[model samples]
Target: MTLQLEDEQAQKLPFDYEELAKQVIDQVLGMEECPYESEVSLTLTDNTKIRQLNREFRKIDKPTDVLSFPLVDFQKPADYDLLESDGWEVYFNPESGELMLGDIVISIERASEQAREYGHSLKREYAFLIAHSMLHLLGYDHMISEEAAVMEQKQAAVLKKLNITREGE
Candidate 1:
């Protein structure tokens, strides 16, 4: 797997984001039963940057903790199709030689707040966000209740595999 992370945030967490991001992505790919090589692009930014993105793409005008831009044409990574439509774009990486999955933008400020509110370590929060974004890259969505439940289970399983559990259980 190839994960390109661009950290544009001012807040510096304790964890090594580059390393942990790869581990979390691998864990999610394993959970999803991905057969071939995969790729993902991640960006760590502050609220302002994420807010700009949210306004441009989602038109929500709010900085969300995480945003997913999946490239797969269909709702499943088994095909890994890069259907050209809307703002979706796909490309290959010369470094890792892996197929491009999609892009993920994470708001560091929001993540910190969520970690505090959820009572988990910053590392655990990062792991969860990265894993959650990986699921989105693999065509997972939480728009519906059933899909949300399934995605939650998959995220939990990925975190469990890496021993990146939530604090106090």
Candidate 2:
């Protein structure tokens, strides 16, 4: 698995991208069921840029901390799919090959504010968001109470493994 990160914000992030990427990839690979070689792109941008993206893609008309764009369907158990839509050919990489899983867009400004509000270090908050995004990339969802609880537990476990804890822990 490969995590391609792009920092487009002027604010400085507290964690190293290489280390963060490794941690995320490691957590993703820990899942025994996943078979494909995954590729994910993460972009850190300011509120303005993220707002534009949110409006354009989700029609939210506001900025959010993280947004996930999944490239393939999670319901199907296939290793990969080669699809042709709108005259565009999209190939889900084979299990042995590189598959573009999806993209995650994060807002550094929002993260910083949340860190302060949550009374935690920026590093911890950022890691949590990254892990959450990674789970979404891997087809984890929290649309309901039970699913949300499970996802939250998994996220907490992953964060603890990374030595990241919430404030007042």
Candidate 3:
């Protein structure tokens, strides 16, 4: 997998964000049984930039913790077969031969705030957000109650597997 990560935030966290993000992304894909090599881009920024993006794309004037932009429309979430069948040239990166999963944008400020609010470490919060966004990139959404529950379960599972607990363990 190729992770193109761009860190544009001024405030640096205590932990290695890139390493954690890669672990979470890889774990999510593994759990979902994605059969192909994948490509994902992640952007770490502050609330100001994320707010602008949120307003422009989602028409929501407020800043969100994270945003996901998925490239493929899967018949089922993490259905690699469907992705492979629907013209591989469109979904696969020409040079890397990796499936272009999607993009993730995270607000470092919002993540820290949420971690404090939830009484968790920043590492756990970041992992949670990345897992959530990775799910979105794989075509999973929480727009409905059932879907939300499933997403929550999956996110928790991913974090637990990585040993990223609420206590930052």
Q: Which candidate is the best by TM-score?
A: 3
Predicted candidate 1 versus true structure: per-residue lDDT over 1-169, tens digit per residue? 7777798888878878899899998877777767657788899999999999999999999889999997664555444443434544344455665667789999989999999998888888888998888888777788999989998998888888888887534
**Candidate 2 Cα lDDT to native:** 0.74
**What's model 3's TM-score?**
0.97
Report the Cα RMSD per candidate. Answer: 3.7, 4.1, 1.0
| TM-score of every candidate relative to the true structure | 0.87, 0.83, 0.97
- Top candidate (lDDT): 3
User: Candidate 3 local accuracy as lDDT?
Assistant: 0.91
lDDT for each residue of candidate 3 in 2-113, tens digit (9 for 90 to 100):
9999999998789988888999999999999888899999999999999999999999999899999999887778877776563757998999989999999999999999
**Residue 159 CA error for candidate 1 (Å)?**
0.5
Ranking by TM-score: 3, 1, 2
Candidate 3's C-alpha runs over 4 A off are none
